[model samples]
Target chain A: MTELNELTIAEARDRLRKGDVTSVELTDACLSAIEGAGALNAFVHNTPEIAREQAAAADARIAKGDAPAMCGIPLGIKDLFCTKGVPSQAASGILEGFTPEYESTVSQKLFDAGSVMLGKLNMDEFAMGSSNETSVYGNAVNPWRRGNDETALTPGGSSGGSAAAVAADLCLAATGTDTGGSIRQPAAFTGITGIKPTYGRCSRWGIVAFASSLDQAGPMTKSVRDAAIMLEAMCGHDPKDSTSADLAVPDFEAALTGDIRGKTIGIPREYRMDGMPEEIEALWQEGIAKMRDAGAKIVDISLPHTKYALPTYYVIAPAEASSNLARYDGVRYGHRAKLEAGDGITEMYEKTRAEGFGHEVQRRVMVGTYVLSAGFYDAYYNRARKVRALIKRDFEQVFADGVDAILTPATPSAAFGLGEMKNADPVQMYLNDVFTVTVNLAGLPGISVPGGMDRQGLPLGLQLIGKPWEEGELLNCAYALEQATGFVEKPGKWW
Target chain B: MSIDTETAAKVAKLARIRVEEDALPALAQEFNTILGFIEQLNEVDVDGIEPMTSVTPMRLPRRVDEVNDGDQQAKVLSNAPDAREGFFAVPKVVE
Candidate 1:
């Protein structure tokens, strides 16, 4: 029998189907891995009894020949997603001790597909920070290393725990949500593959909203094929979410043809900005060279409005977040502060919100409120919206010119030292999202694949962006690149 | 465009967050830093450009006028910490 730690979801399903391994054994392996790697801090909550019971039921179903597509595969869900009876805190003090009675659409879909839940992984508070440091739970340590050094490095965030768990072999696969590169950035930092499907492709119904228009749930896995399988299981239309797309869901796994011959791939000239580290520039060129070797037609294109993406995203995301988070008052489903003498209902609300939200969340809310206030609305929010439209129009023109996909670096540079970014001003940190935010603003599908490592030996990721609703083609190209580059490997023991 | 401590405190109050007066200085400094970064936008020339709201230029579809969401009173009120007679209870405003 293959050791449960090394088995992929497909292999686990095959073993379960042949009656060679019971779901109980697979769940035990994952639970053991979680116990063994407790120092990694990948999981916020692990319920082995619940997982084993679910897995046993799945084993019974398979014995009765009624196995689902994701039968008995144990997966880690990011804590940002709501799971019924499980506390969905978004790793924030504000939402401490809150549990949703209903499940998020993606988590519900995974459960319906017969996947056993391993546990909820950690993330930044309200998905605010780039590094997982902002999490009420501590930062998730990276599962990679520099030679002879065992210092704990960040796995990236706000999905750091999801990426680290998968990289450390603690889970077969994990779920992540990307808003301004949350999924892809961490996946790169941890040497994993993650795809952020187009916005609205996955219903946002029970997801704790962080910038609703940009927020999208995707998969973080060991390989492109694994990501494809998980993405297929996670997508669908729901009337509950008015923004959810009403379209036919395609078999993303079936769409993976390891062929990219004659495909036109565009390299956006604007993404090759000055001040980008030389190593990343080399990796970008290396990606182009590999694609060309694989029979792809590489061409240079320009997204002239690219420089405006960060500013535009900052304005719109916070504006939407400020509105969406208004629902989280003390009286509702989250933490409520104790009332003092002479305090009325207004005081109760003020005190509760003050104690509940974190510094970053509060800062965002203030900025959002300031921009949307009556006098500043048109000057800030409205102007930012116009720039967002121009950015989309730029992509439309490029795609119209026969470019099937665009290639860019996932981030400006590889993972920096743990406290290197935390103390910097917010906009400096927001600039790290420069390359990925444009895709979100355009509502296009984007994926991050392990391209190569930097001089410091940390891994680098190359992003492939596709037009709206073309996730299948986008992932197919990613699989082809994966085969061409061959960059997938386990992180060194220092992790 | 730099914000002072008093302005920061007022902004926090308007945003429904409570910041102790002593903490207002730090908040003001942080806000000024962020505003300083946002000032980069002023450097760009956007002459004759129309402001955009969403990335996709398409307008949202409108549904016919009808009462579609009026039936979930109990479910909605279930989340209320203080509800009476099937309505959310707030402190009376008028004297």
Candidate 2:
């Protein structure tokens, strides 16, 4: 039997509508679960007072018999999102004690829909690292262990906390932002579902900037249907964001008819990376087989520029980050370093940023500054931009040829132990995004669904990349794959 | 091209992040490894390809030139490190 806290968003919405459950009871269940699972370190900031108030309000809204699907549902908001009057640090020391006066556009949409805010979820500092190790709040441990091994594992990052919280049932669902696979990778590691919608699908107005062009906020939830339901609430055209697409938000949940009959699902040949784990390869074969069984045509497609995606991302994301992060110069808000005598504004800026940002963040800023420098701009930044065009064109070509969706392994392998890759070079860590970054580069929608388990009993996820602005179709394909695979395994409550 | 400690120092200064003199060699080496990895992009022949300014084909949305939000100076300055006289207080800029 599923606990109240463990209920998926779709199930909870129905139960609440039928008067089988109350929002306050659900909130208390999640709060108690969060309190008991302190070792996970997923939720860095708890707002029980606000949660209770919102629960009461959600209960009243439901009593009116006009509540939305997310009404009375509790969700953990990612720290990357600016929640009104809540500490909205991006897990960076630079943002210590900082709170937003207004809610992020996406979070406000969720609030307006009557979802109760649970608390702030932890993430990598400025969403830079692949593992949660770079977080100022430390690691958000994965709820799953490798066949009873006591050694803790990373729930992936920079949405590690969202993945962990959802997997551990700390919240029914959580919000996550993906720039180069932050949401999907962590979701893959923690055995949950995460979707990075098309870049302009969700408004980026009030969300803290990472890589502006690549960053997108999407739902991290227990199942694809929940993702579809929550994504409709999270996405819409917003005049607040200049990049926000002026498109209609479809009823994504209704689009899940579980019928991908005769739809073409492409298996991209280039995603078959060298030195990939045997289990991941096996999982990809399983996904393809399941899709074929679901009556979807499986075709071998090629995205030739796939190998160059990570390198291009490293260039563009950092260049934009350095420019975006320059605003945190110790004057307006957030951490301001203590200055010694004879220090001016320049010294202040230098000292504050050096002290405020973590090692990975600083390294990225330094690399960003270098690539955008006067001498290297054309060679590094501009060249990468042109290559990015190629990468985007590669997907456009495949989709233009009538490919509905593409399937690949979400991560090269399942979750790894904490600090396992700390000693490896940073590029070694970056390889984790090799499969998912291409979708971001092409500004396409991508969803990661837990497919099957590895030999160690750890879960592995299969990713489906869809054409631009076709998340509904993509989620349907993922839903069909989900039904075919029947992946209903939950992580043991070790935490 | 491999970055040296001197180049790394220059990059750090340019980024306005302080790196101790002893840390320069390590930072430079780290940059070297990353730059080496990034060098893979140089192999792609992108000579005539247009640099992608936007991923989705959309022109920048134009809005009427008007201030849509204002007032609440307290909220604006609420999170500032130092605020005085309804303005952000900064360290002295001129001698």
Candidate 3:
């Protein structure tokens, strides 16, 4: 029999509903699995007590036949989401020992829908960095090793822990926040499915902000159908988030008809970067063929401004980051360094922030401040915004040409070693976000589905960028692609 | 587009992050690399393109300016590093 911990959210839900298995049994199995997988460093804080409590409640609800789809499901939450009374740091020293008094909208919704909390997972500090190396809790190692090399690889970030946990079977599914490829890139690296919905599709009231305009939360799961179902449960309007869209939630699971009979999938010509690895290119072609086999018309499209997406994203994201992070002074909440007499308020703020933030967070904050400064505002910030508009227009033009979704390689390559990128130039590290950032820049819904593996046998993913507010149709297209590819290889647990 | 140590110091101070003197050179170099990457944006002509503030084409939803709920000071102060008498306590700013 498959271990209870190995079951997908959908499978566990079915078992719990039919009384074949109880929520408590599944929760205990996951707790033991997480306990044994400490070498992965996926979970930073374990709430076995809370997990049991929720599981018992869920079993009661299941017995009463009053449970939702996510009821009795155990999940790991990316440390970015504020779970009340839980240590809700975004894996940043500044937020160390800080527990939120209220639950973030997304996590609260998950709990309200009957999901059990297994623990808080690790992530990049302040949701920065492409690799999990910047996490205050240390790196969450990828379970997928490159054929006995033993060089622990990265699971991508700032949703690194979310991806690692779900991929390692530490949790059935995990909540992840993506501000410019945090969700999709990590999901690709870890060989799980992740979706970043259209901006405002989910409320972001309590998820720690990192580039407010770009940050959107979604689910990372073992399968595409699980992603669709969790995404529907995770999305809805909230009064606390002013930007949350006032729209009705759809039955995303029902929409996954697995038929793309009359759809048109666009292949953006610009995604074929110079010197892309042959494997990634081949995997993308395979994805295109799979979609074509599913009865979808494939058309070549042009997103002319694609080359400028990274730089445009950097300027805009960091500028917004600097402003959003200004609230983290040595004030009412979070870490505050000890101060000596006559060490005035300025010193207090400077010392607290400098001591609290990691190197990358401070670097981005400085860059953001510099770009938004008076002298460079029009040249950098404003110019990036205009370029962003052009980038959005590029997508708009393609969609207007009657394309249902656009297909591209999720990442340039497969899982890389943890310290492999440490000494390289930061710009090179930022290059990992190259293919994934454009979707965030446009605020469109995007999903990364595992397409195939590389020569070394590490997983690679294909991304689907969908029309704004058309996630249901987008998920169906992804389902068709997923069925045709049938790539469901889970990482062999070496941890 | 290159950044010097002096400009790097200025930017760090402006952002309220302390950078040691020895680190300024490295910071300046990193800034140069980032600026160089961003310079690629200059090649694209964005004439007549309005800046995209958001992807959703909706007006900011406004609510009536009235107190919906409040008075839970304990919950608000639960996470504070220092709290006193239903308020957050910070160092004195003025004599």
Model 1, range B42-65, lDDT digits (tens) per residue? 655666677754444445655678
Model 3 alpha-carbon drift over 4 Å, by segment? none
Candidate 2 docking category? high
For every candidate, what share of the true interface contacts is present? 0.46, 0.88, 0.74
Q: Which residue pairs clash in candidate 3? A: none
Q: Write the per-residue lDDT of candidate 3 for residues B1-95, one digit (tens) a residue.
A: 78999999999888887788999999999999888899998898978888887777878899999999999889888878789988887877787
Give the C-alpha miss distance for residue A15 in model 3, angstroms. Answer: 1.0
For model 3 chain A, where is the 10-residue window of minimal lDDT?
Answer: A342-351
The prediction achieving the highest lDDT against the true structure is 2
Clashing pairs in 1: A385-B52, A385-B53, A386-B51, A386-B52
The predicted structure with the larger TM-score, 2 or 3, is: 2
Model 1, which residues run further than 4 Å from truth?
B43-95
lDDT per residue, candidate 3, A20-134, as tens digits?
A: 9999999999999999999999999999999999999999999999789999999999999999999988999999889988899999999999999999999999889888999
- Pairs that collide in candidate 2 are none
Of 1 and 2, which scores higher on DockQ?
2
Distance from true location, Cα of A386 in model 2, Å:
0.5
